[model samples]
Target: MAETRTFDVVVLGGGSGGYATALRAAQLGLTVALVEEGKLGGTCLHRGCIPTKALLHAAEVADAARESETFGVRATFDGIDMAALAAYKDGVVAGLYKGLQGLVSARGITLVEGHGKLVSPDTVEVGGERYTGRNVVLATGSYSRTLPGIEIGGRVITSEQALELDYVPRSALVLGGGVIGVEFASVWRSFGADVQVVEALDHLVPAEDLAVSKALERAFRKRGIGFTLGDRFASVAETDSGVRMTLESGKTLDAEVLLVAVGRGPRTAGLGFEEQGVRLDRGFVVVDERLHTGVGNVYATGDIVPGLQLAHRGFAQGIYVAEQIAGLEPAPIDESGIPRVTYSDPEVASVGLTEQAARERFGDDAVETLDYNLAGNGRSKILATQGFVKLVRRKDGPVVGVHLVGARVGELVGEAQLIVNWEAHPEDVAALVHAHPTQNEALGEAHLALAGKPLHAHN
Candidate 1:
C-alpha cells in the first residue's frame, strides 16, 4: 500500500538545482514538494565546492604565513592542524545548511526525505508513497566518475574522499588536468605535498584559454609542483605504499597516493526517468532550451541536463525552469554566456569565448586581443602574484571574452562577465575608471590597451 500526496510542483533531488527550483516554485505561489535521500545543499555544500574551497583557503593561509617575511610580517609558519581545519570547514557548512533548512520551511515547501524514483511523468515515488505534481523536475545532480579498469579503493580515491582526508599525503599523483585535477593538485602542493599531475591533454586546465594554461604551468613549476604535459595516461597499479602510474611515453611515476581527478557523470541511473518517456542521451537527461523534457510537464536541470555542470549554472537553470513552468516565459539562457572559474593556485576565470574560439566564431581578422600583465597592477604586485588579464574583442566592436589568471582573480570575474554579457566595447570599458592600485584595474588596463590608449603596457 502506497500513500498518495499531491503538489503543484515536484522537484527530485535536494541539491543546488533541485533546491533552487523548489524555492522559486514555492515563491511563485506553487505548492512544491522537494525530495532528497541525502543532505540538502548536495555536493557543492557538503563536499564539492564549499569544503574544497575551505581547504584551498586553509592552504592560502598556510602559504601566506610561510611567506609572511616577504610582506614584512614577523610570523612563524607552522604545519597544518587537520582537525581544526576540518572543524572550521564543517562549521561553515552546518551554519549554511541550517539557514537553507529555515528558508525551505518558511517558504512552505514540503521537504520529503527519501530516495525518489519517478513512477510517472507527473509522480515521484518514495518510501512506498506517491507524490504527484502537475509539473516534475529532475535535478539528481552528478557523481565523480572513474575510468574503465580503474578501481577506486585504498590509496586511489575520488574527490569525495579527498575532501575528507585527515592528513595530506607526502606525495601524490593526480590523473586528469582539468578543473578538479588541477585544483586538488594546487591544494596538495600548497600543503607541502610532492605532487605530479598527469594530463592526457596538451596542458593543464586545457579547456581554459591556452595562455591561462601556460601561465598556470609556469606558476605551478615555480612552486615546484611537477606535471607531465602532452602525455597520455596508460595504466596505473596499486603499490605497497600507494600507486605506480605508467604514461604512454614509457615514463613511470610513483606516489604515496593517486587521486583520480577525472570528472563527474550525471547521477541518473535507475531513477525511472526513461521509463516515464523522459529522453536521455547516455546517462544525461535530454532537455531543450527551455529545460523541458520529452514527457509533458517534465523538465530537468543541473548536471543531469548535459551542460555546464556548475552549481551556479544549476541554480540559474533551476530558477529558469521554475519560472517557465509558472508561465512566466523567462528568457532562455545561453550556455556559453555562463561564467566559469577554476579555483586553483593562480586561479583561472573566464567568460564568453576563448581566444581561439573567438577567432573561429568571428574570424581571425575580426578578433583582436590585449594581454595586460599583472606586473602593472599595484595590488597584484603588492600581493606578489604573477599573471595577466587577456581580453578578446572584435577589431572594432564590443569585448567578446575576458580571461584572468593570478591570485584572487576569481573575485573579479563578476565584472568581466557583465562586460561580456552586455557586449561592452573596449572604448566603453576604457572610459570607466577602475579604482587605482587594485587587481580589477588589470581589466581596465587591458581595455585601455585594446582601445590603443596603451596605459601601463607596451604596444
Candidate 2:
C-alpha cells in the first residue's frame, strides 16, 4: 500500500538549496513538500561548513592564547582538550540545527522523511509513496570526492571522519590544497600536529588569484606548515602505526592519518534523474541560466547544478528558482557575482573578476589594479597579521574585483561584493568614508589609490 499526496511545489533532497527553495516557495503562498533522507540543513550546516569552521575557531583561540604574551596579556598556552572541543563544536551545530528545524516547522512546509527518487518530471517517489507537485526542485547536494585507487578507511579519512576524531594525531598529511585541504591543515597545525600538505597544483588554493595564493603560501610557511606543490601522489601503504605515502616527486612521508581534503562531487546517483528525462552532465543535473531543467515543470539548484557548489551560492540559486517557478520574473543569477572565501589562517576572500580575468576580458591597458598593504591598517597592525587588499577596476569605469587576505578579512567581503556587483567606480567608493582604524579601511585605501588620491598607502 502506498500513500499519495499532491502539493503546489515539491523539493527533493532537503539540503541548503532544497530547503531554501521550499521555504521561499511556501512564503509565496504555494503549498510545498520538502523531502529528505537525512536531517535538515544539509552538509554546510551539518558537516562541511559549520563543523569545520568550529574547529578553525577553536584553533584560532588556541593561537591567540599562545601569542597572548605579545599583547601584554598574562596567559598560558595550554594544550587542547579534545573532548571539550568536540562537544563545543557539536553544540554549535545542534543549536543551528534546532533553529532550522523550528523554521521549517513554523513554515508549515510538509517535511517528508525518506530517500526520494524522481519517477517523472513533476513526481517523486519515496518509501513506496508518490508525491506529486505542480513543479519539482532537484537539490540533491554533494559528497566528499576521492581520487582513483585511493582508499579512505582506517587511518585514511575524509573531512567527515576528521571532524569526529576524539583525539588529535601527532602528525597529519593532508592531500589537496583547495579550501578543505588548507583549512584542515591550518587547524591541525595549530593543534600541535606536524602538518604536511600535498598539493598537485602549483600553489595552495590554486583557483584563487595568483597573488592571494602566494600570500597564503608565505603565511603557511611562516607558521611552519610544510607543503609540496606541483607534485602528484604515487601511492599509499598502510602500516601498524600509520600510513606511508609516496609522491611522484620521489618524496616519501608518513603520518598517523591522511586527511583527504580533496573536493566534493555531486550526489546525484540512483535518484532516477536522467531516467525521468532530466538532463545530466557527468552526474550533475543540467539546467539553464534560469535554473529550468530540460524536463517539463522541473528545476534544479544547489551543488547538483554544476557551479560553485557553495552553500551560499546554493541559497541564492534556490531563491531564484523558487521565484522563477512562481512566475516572479526574477533576474538570472550571474555566477561571477557570487563571493568565495577560504577560511584558513590568513583567510582569503574575493568577489568579481581577478586582475588577470579583468585584463583578459577588458584588456590589460584598460584595467588598473591596486594592492593596499595591511601594514598601513591599524586594525591589522594591532592584530599583528600581514596581508593586503587588491582591487581591480576599469581604467576609467567601475570597480570590477576585490581580493583580500589577512586575519578576519573574510568579514569584509560583504562590502567588496557590493562594490563589484553594483558596478561602482573607484571614486564612488572613495567618496564614502569608512570608519578609521579598521581593517575595512584597507579596502577604502585601495580605492583611494585607484581614484588618484592615495591615502595611508604608497602611490
**RMSD list, candidates in order:** 1.1, 1.0
Global lDDT scores for all candidate models? 0.91, 0.92
Instruction: Give one digit per residue, the lDDT tens place, for model 2 in 1-459.
Output: 577799989999888899899889988989999999999999999888999999999999999999999999989877999999989999999999999999889999999999999998889999899999999999989999998878999999999999999988999999999999999999999999999999998999988889999999999999999999999999898988999999998899999999988899989999998888888888888888889887889999899898797999999988998898888999999999899998999999999998889999998899988899999889999999999999988989998889999999999999999999999999999999999889999988888888999956434
Clashes of 2: 0
TM agreement with the true structure for every prediction: 0.98, 0.98
* Model 1 C-alpha lDDT versus the unseen true structure: 0.91
Best by lDDT: 2
lDDT of 1 by residue, 1-459 (tens): 666888989999999999999999999999999999999999999989998998899889989989999999999877888899899999989999999999999999999999999998899999999999999999999999988867898888999999888998999999989999999999998899999999988899988899999999999999999999888878889888889998889999999999998889999999999899888898999888888997889999999998787999999998999999899999999887799999988899999899999999989899998788898889999999999999989888989889999999999999999999999999899899999889998888888888889866545
The runs of at least 3 residues in candidate 2 whose Cα sits more than 4 Å from the true structure, single-residue gaps closed, are none
Span of 10 residues, lowest total lDDT, candidate 2? 450-459
